[model samples]
Target chain A: MSDHKFTRRIFLSGAVVTVTALSLTGCTEPKTQLVKIEQAGAFFNPDDLTLLNDIAEIMIPRTGTPGAADAQVAAVIDAMMMTWANGATRDLFSNTLQKIELMAETLKGKPYSSLTLKQRQSLISEIDVRAFSDEVPDYAEGYKRLKDLIFRVFYSSEAANADYVPIPGQYRGNLTLDEYESLTEAYSYGG
Target chain B: MADEFDVIVVGSGVTGGWAAKEFCEKGFKTLVLERGRHLDHPDPEYTDMLAPWEAENAGLMPESFEDAGRYSMLRKKGRLYKSQWARFFVDDKEYPYSFPKDRPFMWTRGYQLGGRSITWGRQSYRWSAKDFEANAKDGNGVPWPIGYDDLAPWYDYVEAFAGISGAKDDVETLPNGDFLKPWEMSCAEQFVSDNLKKNRPDRPMVIGRCANLSEVRPIHTELGRGPCQARNMCKQGCSFGAYFCSLSSTLPAAERTGNLTIVTDAIVTSVLYDDKKGRATGVSVVDRKTKCLRKYKAKVVFLCASALGSVQVMLNSRSDARPKGIANSSGLLGCYIMDHFGGAGATGVVPGFEDRYSFGRRPTGIYMPSFRHEKADDVDFVRGYGYQGGGSTRPRTSHTGKKVGIGAAVKEHVGKALPWRMRLIMYGEMLPYIDNRASLHPVKTDDWGMPLLHIDAYGRDNEKKMLVQAAKDAEDILIAGGCINVKSSHVNPENHIELGSRTHEMGGACMGSDPKNSVLNKWCQAHDVPNLFVTDGASMSSCSTQNPSLTYMALTARATDHAAKLLKEGVL
Candidate 1:
């Protein structure tokens, strides 16, 4: 299995790099090269990529199980946008990303990527309040769609199946509710 | 040139397959006509075997297909799940329909050999004595010419062949059929069932009886099929043929008889009625692929072209004897439509039981049989509905706690989540009203120049009241069972059954004792044309809440046998 690894420095840099220098020497084929950025991953704007990585890490940081970054959620989202999503879904995602960037620029005079952890947290909290409120209809709708898509892409990834949600081999219909609950909870928690 | 055949049965769906099978098996050469293309069973185009990671859209319907207008009603019914398996069944561009501006009908349908049987929910239930006697007692719609006893033996015959897996829940209202071992329920489901039974002694919750073969019988095994893998991917068309479908079961059986001749893409335009013989001689068919018109001869003609599809053919077949439409003596031929008004129920989170876990995904749910018609005292609605529900643990959600902090709190939150529970669903009855009817489109014509069906139907006041009450009753039961966060929602009245969408769509050419009241006789033969038989949903007198496929199968079986007997006795 390919190791889906990303570093903070490599993510921040706009230039794409390979894990091994041998591929750079032209001895190996481009398709065979491991640890290269996926096509879907390439769609993420360099600045937006950094912000997404940072926010996802905050949402589901590295624990005993792999986090959102480890699941390649950004790549999934990028693929979803390019292939599956229609015009409206793509617009919704792009608009939300732009809103986050603009909000960060207004608060700190810098991109969301350049913001401190504390500054990012405060900005997100403010956005969350507005997003969750019934008064802010547009933001609420956007947030719900954004939140659902993010989770759908992340948890449904192969990474989550291996380390997070374990697929059972057989169905035993007589198991108790508590038993089902614990297993599901554990699966959700990336056990 | 009009192609000739010994027998031509319109619509290669559930009823069509049965009629074809019976005729073929009896050593009579038969030609099966279908409006749609052929879909091979076992290796059908859409099978949900692909993993989530492998899927292009991860089960979200593509907007392009939705925009094509063929799936207008289908999109609302959760049929638009965008996956690898979606392409085979969902084709919105080729098949389309137009509804009234004020009344929108979601005609959720697929035109193929197996028809909607390829993607049916497979919940099988028997109609009791009450369902058979409903129209007779109520006097609302035409009374069923035949009673439960006439269909009982046929039900056993079909069940034995189809391999219905269910437990015999000895309820008088819901008669038990020939069943295989019932599929097991989850621990949470068992607890809820036990508590509900003990508390509410009137209502009994039994395991859902489905057409899926839990354990393969010798008959099924002889046909080269095996037991179900418990994958719960039935909507994609089971590759193993563990579930019953026209492609997987009847069509194959007919093929083995060597008397069945299936001609795909042959759209039946009208039944050629012989005025002198006072019978349908054959059918005029148009090749959907080649745009060529042809005629076929047959001793007996069966119109199993769905409910509305059959009605369309009947209404299109104009003769001097019947000017309004074929066998339109009563004018009740295209009236009194009925469907199970679905999407009424309450869901809630279970309070306890955190220790139990289940293994594989069981395909079926627990069914709460009808408690309304136990002893008919005054209820708001005339007919009652049954609840088909089950309990399940909550799956993962994508809510990130403390949105902007890359810390241990986020890690901790993702590590220890709790499992929540919810109910399956309930479907109530929509009373058969004369006003709720299907008629030929005034201006619209299909791709083949056949008149399109203009279905303007809705649930009546009684149906709305039944749904409202049923929703409340479901909520009360869940709350009484110590459930939290109980929420109830009613599906839009316009959305229920899509008018002719359920594929269980019944009663356009209903059966009655008198020729002035119904289109087909008790034997499913048209009253005006002796040799013409309408054995599909159009022959149903009333629409019971139970999945109507099994009943259609039984009725078709009985009708074919009766037709054969009548033919041999020189009655025609």
Candidate 2:
């Protein structure tokens, strides 16, 4: 469920304060809080985390709101890979990363990590277009899965600040955008 | 005296909860035996409060962690099985049952203090007069000893206490109950309902009557229950007591009476019978974890374990006088098994109403009571089916089968909500066939040293034809309401829908007039054994195309009254 009271810009800015508070000594964690940001992204090595982080940022770049990087979607992915993914899924992701590196080397004469932001963006755009196109080859399939996962993880994250109501006491069958927005704003935060 | 209770109710699920509440309220010392681990009210294991991202893997369980082979059915079913809420469901590797090698039966179970009532689909509907008379009219199975009139008062009683949310829709096939205010339909749903009324008057669409408390009553409030918050995360136990469950409503009421005792991890192995006295004296139980045996004495025993659960227990309760099984003189303890056939439906997008969107996730949908209920020349099936569907607006996520480019553009695209799209899934009554039955596997036994239930139920011609008609009618209704791209799924040729998928399994120890042909009587009392009663889905002579939990609760409450009266009058 999404809570739309605070916009992504507001939530992203507020996150800086949250991070500072989290690091402060003698400040107890929230009672019901299960997972922390530090616990995530531990599955992947430094190089893989870097690649994942950059690719996630490219997939959902920061505009007027927080992007995939701010959402820490890549960290979520790493956590999932460490704990959730099976052998088959892990292999698929690993191979897909290797393929991306190979593609970067073949096209721009360097590894994907070594490329400039502009070069990486152009290469990713090419891959994204080819992956979704009707004439997509088997190689592009993994990219489609990766792209979908990135979007899914980002949207589900707290940084996305999508309109969600954990507990709206009543149901309204029909409402205008203005009415819905006001209602969500009123019943915003929940555990 | 320490091990004895006035009444022992086996299983603390939908029926068992009601039984405990009623008997305890009536001042009987009731002991509820649960085969699973104890779960407290507002269960600590609940993930209902967890945010989407806060859950591990965003609520998806890791593939490597779960057992693929043992939980093959759940693995194949996907989604719900692989969710964080899978903690509520039983592990198949531990509590295994068997069916035919070729035919798979998905017996979805939750082994906890509240049982499957913790995760029940909450849709509440009353079966009509036609449902009761179907068996006799069609000469299929035995006639129901009780009719709609017999259960109407009981239904009213349960509906008041349980707090059903439904309108008085004046539909004969679906009788209205003592209800709280019904949940509101979405704008798109209202439009479709109006259109169906104007054009297809015969097929009326009404709001789903569910167990969720739309408005809290004094009876519900007194039990510490509150109004539904429209969170829709009910599968994970609700702490607010907004939705009706054993842990939320009935069990707490039972506990307040101070006449109720509960024993967790006590698997009821059999009902101890006294042949000379012609009474069920007590229950034999095995400790789930330690495998230690114990017996609890009771004046009366209510087998409110699920339909199959009761059937398995009854079939295994063999004695010298009743060599086949206790209270099984009819030799039909595990016969005429029935579950709703489903998985055939239509989905389409409504053209307009883009600007209108509903606030709060209402934990209900629209229900179309079966128009094919009566005998008609047009229809080839015996019983009928109902459609549970709803209209909703969503952004073009992965669920919508749309392809969008990456980056800012895709993010923007997903932000804007799409027009309301509608989908309908049908639940048709599976005709009670004698051959489609449950029996003990000759040799196989579980770790508890109880016989493994071998389910052999499958859909026949009636179910197949009904599902096919259901799909056609669903598409026709959507088309009439001006929906586009109406696509209907076809029934599988091999096995119609997987048996027990709908989770409304009913009919094994069926109630009928003749004791020679049935296990129980009109009052759900065992004919051969007076003090033993089955008030669960097991006593149903006919499985109607409605959610059966409400009926089971009503029956348990009514039967408890009858049993209590008899106990006081020294009838037993």
Candidate 3:
């Protein structure tokens, strides 16, 4: 009240006119949730979200660039395991996606999204080149945790927001990478 | 008009924005206060224009939700948890404090309105007469009655209005200012600064002086601020006020000297001390959104509230003529509590620049300064250790658990730049421990019931043998500079040491000629309340190794110009 000039639209219109002028003077207190609902809770299972969105579209399929299922990265890994996985990282990412559907029904049979995209990219390159930390195995740590959570949601989407330069309007710092790609514009090489 | 008048300034930060811009440009009538909430500088709660794939937890923040698990202790601090600079830091569960679980300090706070000078690490440097003659030449606790030619003209008047950016190089252990044009360094930091100066010619390096404008003057384009477009996105605040914060340079020059005011959720919580006008006759605050209590008055108060938050407002200011708090009649207000022993160092890989890269994002790094200082103590430690870090022709965070590889060649190898690599880190100099103190928690109390402080502080045994000889002398200067697969930090003796992970906190009301062992004197005033001053990082008499907010803005502009020339000689 001592004029700090903030804005979340003047704080939800001054908290909805102070809770509608304290409920039109019927004054009942205990109200406060000033907005923050978002909880629907699901963290996979519609057949492990259709085998983790068909193994995140064969590790980012669409080629002319926009991959990881064109960036809907399994709905940001189901909203980061329903608001950021906690219970021991949602039980170690649900026992590594149920050991990648029991290692695709004991080595490529019925489910890991019913194989064949060249045998699911050669069993995701042999369960992602094995040995993925915390001492491996859980279908080699769920193909290295769903391939590092679909490369951290396709390197932060909007189809990897054209490798930022943010407010990099200018700042030379001694060029020459062909004078920094002929002065500016040429960075997007990934991540 | 604001209950307080000729000078109040409890803590808007960076020593209450240089004592409310030198007490409102010498005409006084200032106020300031701010225990969080107002944040204006490019404020839309600045996420330095987001884009690192704008949020949905991209810039980081997923330690399992609930507002990022209420900032899991600032996600163990490193680069202050960046999911949009963790919503401008501070909130140890509604500002609680306490310490000592086998010595674990981590008291990092940020509390808005430019506090924590909007998440610091603006690394400024300067402090030199061998860091004010190393605490009276290593007896080690109280000395600094002002040195480096009494702060080289207040660090050339706050680096000519806070611009800095480096490359001066006079370097007698970092002492050169009024800079501006610098930020270059990365042909793999000029080949590890010419192979660590052909092997340690007293450890040279340079570059990172910082604060950032990299050329701006016209008094910073008449103070609207610009330059620093390096866009390393300064903990998401700078919006081209290109660095030097406290709402981009001294509370907008004390809001263009119309004799400042500020307030914002107030909260000072102590310093009134009247007892027959012995002096400090103001401040009691509270509101932080209606926890109520008020007070104000003033003739001069200051206490830039940090470094154990102005000794937790002079230990919750109880009275009875200094009952262990207020001017603290040298019960040395909260003993000596300090900070900077930093998480040690290392990292490697610098082979060849691969055709010289790095064109911008140079938000600084490449300092080195300490070189085991104090006329080369040569170990058994007393004070030294600098080496900040640099060289990254790329490959640092390919994000989450070192991503192996997948899709379009891992999105063109995580937007490229993985060849050179470097790092350094170190920090050191912690000494000050009179049982590394900071008191208060007689029983905890917080969320505005106040009293939680308690912090104990640690890092002794001369800061664990200077963080294991500054991490094996930063892996022997990254394998003597051509760096290979180096690596360091993991210094043991059974590890531990997380105390305030380098938020660079400082002493607890220190300064002393001898107000019976100190609680502000060598002009940080209040030998026992003469108008009660306290230039922040609370009067730091010792914790030296540079970067202590450019000596708390040259000791709050040389103690608010000696309390505005003793308030025009009426003697404060």
What's the TM for model 1? 0.86
TM-score of chain B of 2: 0.97
Alpha carbon lDDT of residue B474, candidate 1?
83
User: Model 2: how large is the Cα RMSD against the reference?
Assistant: 6.1
DockQ of 2: 0.35
User: lDDT tens digits, residues B1-572, model 2?
Assistant: 48988999999999999999999999999999999998898876776887666655655555754535545556655766645467777767778999988788888887888888888889999999999998998999999998899999999999999889999999999998878998998887888888898989898989999999999889989988888898888888888888889998899999999999999999999999887788888999999989999999999999999999999999889966666777888889889999887878998887777777678888999999888767689887787888998884433444211354667776665566777888899988878888888999899999999999999889877877877778888999998877888998867745635787887889899999999999999989999989999999999998888889999988998999999999899896
Ranking by TM-score: 2, 1, 3
2 against 3, candidate with superior TM-score: 2
Q: What's the lDDT for residue B303 in model 1?
A: 94
Tens digits of per-residue lDDT for model 2, A68-181: 777867666775675567777788887888788788898789877667777877887787777778877565767777776787778778777556677888888788888888
Number of the predicted model whose DockQ against the real structure is largest: 2
Per-residue alpha-carbon lDDT of model 3 for B17-57, expressed as tens digits? 88898889888889888888897878877767656655535
Better of 1 and 2 by TM-score: 2
- List lDDT for all candidates, in order: 0.71, 0.81, 0.72
lDDT for residue B534 in candidate 2, whole number 0-100: 98
Among residues 3 or more apart in sequence or in different chains, the pairs in candidate 2 whose N, CA or C atoms overlap within 3 Å are A2-A163, A2-A164, A3-A164
Q: What is the lDDT of residue B99 in candidate 1?
A: 62
Please, what is the TM-score per model? Answer: 0.86, 0.92, 0.34
